[model samples]
Target chain A: MTIRSVAIIGLGLLGGSIGLAIREKLSEVTTTGFDADADVRGRATANGLVGAVCDTAAQAVASADLVILCVPVGAMGDAARGLAGCLKEGAIVSDVGSSKRSVVSALEEALPDAIVIPAHPVAGTERSGPDAGFATLFEGRWCILTPPKNADTDAVSALTLFWQELGATVELMDPDHHDLVLAVTSHIPHLIAYTIVGTASDLEDVTRGEVIKYSAGGFRDFTRIAASDPVMWRDVFLNNRDAVLEMLGRFTEDLTAMQRAIRDGDGDRLLEIFSRTRAIRQAILEQGQDVAKPDFGRGSKEV
Target chain B: MTIRSVAIIGLGLLGGSIGLAIREKLSEVTTTGFDADADVRGRATANGLVGAVCDTAAQAVASADLVILCVPVGAMGDAARGLAGCLKEGAIVSDVGSSKRSVVSALEEALPDAIVIPAHPVAGTERSGPDAGFATLFEGRWCILTPPKNADTDAVSALTLFWQELGATVELMDPDHHDLVLAVTSHIPHLIAYTIVGTASDLEDVTRGEVIKYSAGGFRDFTRIAASDPVMWRDVFLNNRDAVLEMLGRFTEDLTAMQRAIRDGDGDRLLEIFSRTRAIRQAILEQGQDVAKPDFGRGSKEV
Candidate 1:
């Protein structure tokens, strides 16, 4: 594979950003993105995120060495099926879906004759659209690849280098393991956020207004997470239902215990749990995942 | 009564910040603060957050024209009764407790002859202690005041002026209304945060480790919320039980609906509700309650 051309399907935040990242990393690579929405393709080209806006998925991947699928998780199988025939004989196919097991399995069955590699670039924001994409979006973020056991080593190496060149540190894991890790890290957290923010949205009109007014205290954080792309998240929860619900059950049980502690005025138990959680925040800071200061160094010189 | 001297009891984050705000805004006021922890009193005086440090609540309240109780909600009653006799004649007392109804009721019943008003500064951070105090902490924030029905008008005016001078936009409301408002905004949010973090804290060791590693996506937000002053939040949920439970019931019901929608693959319904919440984020931005950027404008400007 000469690897001179790349096709990115879905010119939303992830795909558009990948287009920019790849272009920045490999100047010789001619990137073409095809979005189902013409406006997205138009915007991606206008923003210089893609060198060319392919007229169709087949047109984009017609002569590319790598074809990327960055759509909603639920749409992966259909997209894989659509591109199965158009993809070059030995070209590598990958996705940036949050989940892995089901997506990989579906892509495998949908494109039995094509080599599909499932990779998740663990970076993003609540914002979507081509305008929200940026080249350095993947800096210092992890990108996990879950390739089938029988997949070609050369194809995997090529895919790894492609993501690594975009400023992501690549890691390989079993598809099932990737799903489990994400369920714990990303999916469950988002579910809880959506649930809490939804809870506030249902309050009596007066209280709902107050919740919005004073959200910066804590609830606002949940609202930001809850505000993530709903179609994408809904598909994630539905596809990863068993895992999300399982983790949610654990969460609710723990919540119920805390509720009881509050009711019983068990300050010791509350403080103990708070102390443990604070240590986790410290660990996140140590790992460079979060800032040590409350303002996260952004408001270092605030008004 | 000439307002020459003021007493700030409990000298922690809220008390120290109040001392700083008062001293910075009121040049004529000579402020003294006392804390159960000797080190807090020493630090407050040494750091110049207060004009003086006293060994006892009685010592601090004696001869002061006004007294402000900035302790945990659970201790408001004790602080109220303890200073009743020691407070100078005609001295006005107020608090910065989060739960207005409980604190007001407690203070009214415990110190019938003393002037008491309950207030909440709708601002703070996860960090506590005297060193965390800042004069700007209350700036651009709302200080919700809950004065009793038969409260002295002059006393209310003086306190309102005090907060306004500290750069807060003070609003007056009934104590019950204040409680209801906070139940939706502060108390309910903290309860959810504590519950979610407790959930993550109890996960299997391997999964728990990964949760910390990848927390930046969303869980990190909840962790910061959950890491709030534990004692303060425990008292909030317990004292405002009726309102919090009511709001919690509404929230649980809403969450059930969201879960059902996701389980059934109802993308439109999820999108509608999630989209609605995005407007709330926008409102927070417009109102200057929260910034519009992710990671709260942390991370690199380009990334």
Candidate 2:
């Protein structure tokens, strides 16, 4: 069945962007959105992020064929439980959480009767909140859907089509695999960034002011990733602790190996690894996942 | 003396950009440049990276009042030694190496009779070589000079003026302090980026294709940094081993703490660190070291 009416449970960056994308691209789809914060709800409504801003999650999902919970991963179970008795039978339920295994388990347990498909759109800016979203945020981005093994094929296809219509390339994977994959590509990178930025700030010899002034040397890039929504990332790390710790373990081992190479003055080994990593960047660019411009296109633009 | 002739050795990104910037900004200064690679020398000549591309390092340094060595940190001694007898008496000599302590010592030992002053322009893109340069590459960026205590004040001022003319802000730092600051800002960041990208590539559960496709989730930024010139980075890690290792130790401690928080479900600690790092990003932006636009302004530009 086609998704004609949609309800978004959280009007933050991901949720607000979904609402805006739907309104801008699928004009026929009726959008209903709600947020825990009153100010966020007001901003989302005034910005035309949704056609209707409901006061309650139950009111938002009552008439909708699709309900997407866009809250933090830690809050997924509670948000799902709040939708009890409101979701229409056969209506598809989904979420935009960074981690899939825990979220899928929480959602499936909370809504046993609904068709739950956990998905994550691998796209975002460092900004957060209702006003930090845009219509084209999903354009050229990937959305991975982790549906249960016994999920209805038609429901999965419909959810895939819904994301496709909003400008996302869709993929299907098991929930465990999704968590593992995202842990490597997203979670570990963020953890390293946060750790390094904090490390730089806490240095006594290198003043914080000096670090900020000379950040363009390379530290600024890490700052951007570390500046991502704190609560959401904290939830991600907590929810996906197993996968995150596993990947971080591998990262620490590799980092220690590199550290030993540097300490031993192994230029050949350092060059080998550095050269190998350069090809991956080229692959990312060739795959159309990133821009080829130098400095991530930061130097060409005006402030 | 008001410098009129400038010689550039190495003719790569930093050297070529210096030539281009001199030609664009200081029209009266005669530029001579030389690179070890014949193809790079020919390209620098054709691209007008310098007024004259010399056939040998000796020729490049023979007639210039100011000579700057733009080679990898490990190669600075060899490059400086190559100009031993060719440099005119009383001519100023400097270098653009990421690590200051080793480079200053190398140049001072190799060209003991010349005015050896080491400087590092804290500006670059991922790409390297002669073609990866522009006249405005150093605009508004910091160029740090670490001159010896016994160095002539007029020579230091002249070097500072030369970089300022090319649109760089000049700062005077001791060699050890410069190396320590850059160890936090540039060297360690590049090392972590390379390590994480390599770690992601070596994953057994996730396919390389999958990692590349979902890279926008945060991995893409690290790839850009890891894509930087491998040889230069190798030399940096070798020359700045002490400081980089020191900072990496602190980073490991911080990351271990973060890992513990994640494992123990300490949301408060994660949130506190994340929130603190966000303010550093803001401070970097306020200092004009980074753009305020989200995602390094990658979303607004076309590939």
Candidate 3:
């Protein structure tokens, strides 16, 4: 049940990283990659991101036992459909999309003959594209797999082992729950980051130059998250609308309460919430989910 | 107008950093510091955070040419009042609070005879207290000065030169304008971060463990900011109420527009805002306010 050859359908950050990780961690498993963009394919070849850089998605998946569609979530159907007749028999098709429910349905609809198991590696930097990735991108990170209930157990086990070898911890969850969790943990955060950056720049009294100069005052953190890939995030909101909107409703309500506290000068209420949130940060550090040093350890010479 | 002796009223992150920076950069200037908390005072003495860790505010400010209050904004008036009769006749009184207008008024009211020139060093880490201070904390960061109109020009120049000696770039801003500008750059961002972290941890459907495990996706960045000193933030919100509310209103409007776009499946609208925010990150990098490397260079061993 082991994956012998892996195919990456998009040579962007996620795809390129997967190929590089496989090379570094599972050299026995051959890798091939392709991107719709010719420029990216050229760079991937130069960087040796995969064992081979194919000219087309069909060519990439022709002999791969595991075919991972790494395109934006909105392009999942097309990416899957492109490999409709090219996948090897018994090939396990998967993706690394932020939202799971929509991706699960899209892949199933497009590749009915292929075994579909969607996964999301909850790790990344703000940068994108082939040059932005590294072999250790998934090190000590969580990768949740959402396989259809009727999927083969052997295939799921094999896929889980594959990710584990690439330095990721694997978990299985329902597609719907995965979407809800990510909406709170990832999607809503990115949405808010993007919104705040826009809000800061559009202010009339505070010039954009001022925002840029004094960004150490906590605004620069949002800028990093907002600088993430726009197309990937745009597709995430479009695909995970219900979960994102639900989480956004909760966040907006909480924010309004905080605003009221500020307007009313209720120092006690503000203190309570601000104090409680610090423990969550402690939990994150304890769980090895984040770095513990101050400013993400950015101030030190060695991170 | 040269400052020969400087006093610090609160030996916490901001205060302690000032002491250490002065010791490293301005070896000729003598520093005396005091904190209201006995344990912090003990720690300040053990860490050599100042040339002398005084037992009382009056003793700390006596004979000093510049006294900087580094307590919470809510405590500025009390800290200044403690130093009323101890300062030299021409000594300058300043503070390192987030909100400028309230701090300026509080200091002026508390020490009517002293030359009050409020300043805010737009630099800090989430970690606080005397032990958290570092000599390079203000390196390459901005220290904004807001002086009353009738203030002596020589005193203002001396204070500006002092901050420059501590490795911070200095800027002059009106007290009210500084409050409004910081509302967008610091206060509102902190408010939103505190709100989101609270929302994520309180969700009934999502376990706290799950939230912590997947935080790297985006939520962790907010947690770093949310982990800031609660008392400091509480005072910031209370003091900068109008500006924070105004900026929050604009942010809410932008968020609502984004929510509608998601609900209506308007991918173009989502992409537009997401794309525009990336440029702001670039501008911040160009301004040298932040590191140019990705993830604030967290991934690299050499940050």
Which one is best on TM-score?
3
Candidate 3 per-residue lDDT over residues A179-220, each given as its tens digit: 999999999999999999999999899999999988999999
At residue B276, give the lDDT of candidate 1: 70
Task: Write candidate 2's Cα lDDT for B54-160 as tens digits.
Answer: 99999998989999999888999999999998998889999889999888888989988899888999999888999988888888889999989998999999999
**DockQ of candidate 2 (2 decimals):** 0.72
The clash count of every prediction, one per candidate, is 0, 0, 0
Candidate fnat values, all: 0.54, 0.77, 0.78
Looking at model 1, residue B32 earns an lDDT score of 88
For residue B25, what is the lDDT in candidate 3?
Answer: 91
- Which ten residues in a row are the worst by lDDT in model 1 chain B? B294-303
Give the Cα error of residue B199 in candidate 1, in Å.
1.5
The 10 consecutive residues of candidate 1 chain A with the worst lDDT sum are A294-303
The digit string of per-residue lDDT tens for model 3 on B69-167 reads 999999999888888788888888989999999998888888888789999999998989999888888888899999899889999999999999988
**How do the predictions measure up, each by TM-score?**
0.93, 0.98, 0.98
Cα lDDT tens digits for candidate 1, A140-247: 777889999988888898888888888877889887777767777788888767777766666665566677777656666677777788888877877887777777
Q: Write one digit per residue (lDDT tens) for candidate 2, span A1-303.
A: 989999999999999889988988899999998888899999988888889999998989998999999999999999999998899888999999999999988998998888998899999888899988878788888999999989899999999999999889999988888889999999999999999999999989999988987888888999999999998999999988999999999999999999999989999999999999988899998887777666654653312
Sort order, DockQ high to low: 3, 2, 1
DockQ of 3: 0.73
After aligning candidate 2 to the native by TM-score, how far in Å is the CA of A90 from where it should be?
2.7
Each prediction's interface RMSD? 2.2, 1.6, 1.6
Give the Å error, residue B7, model 2: 0.7
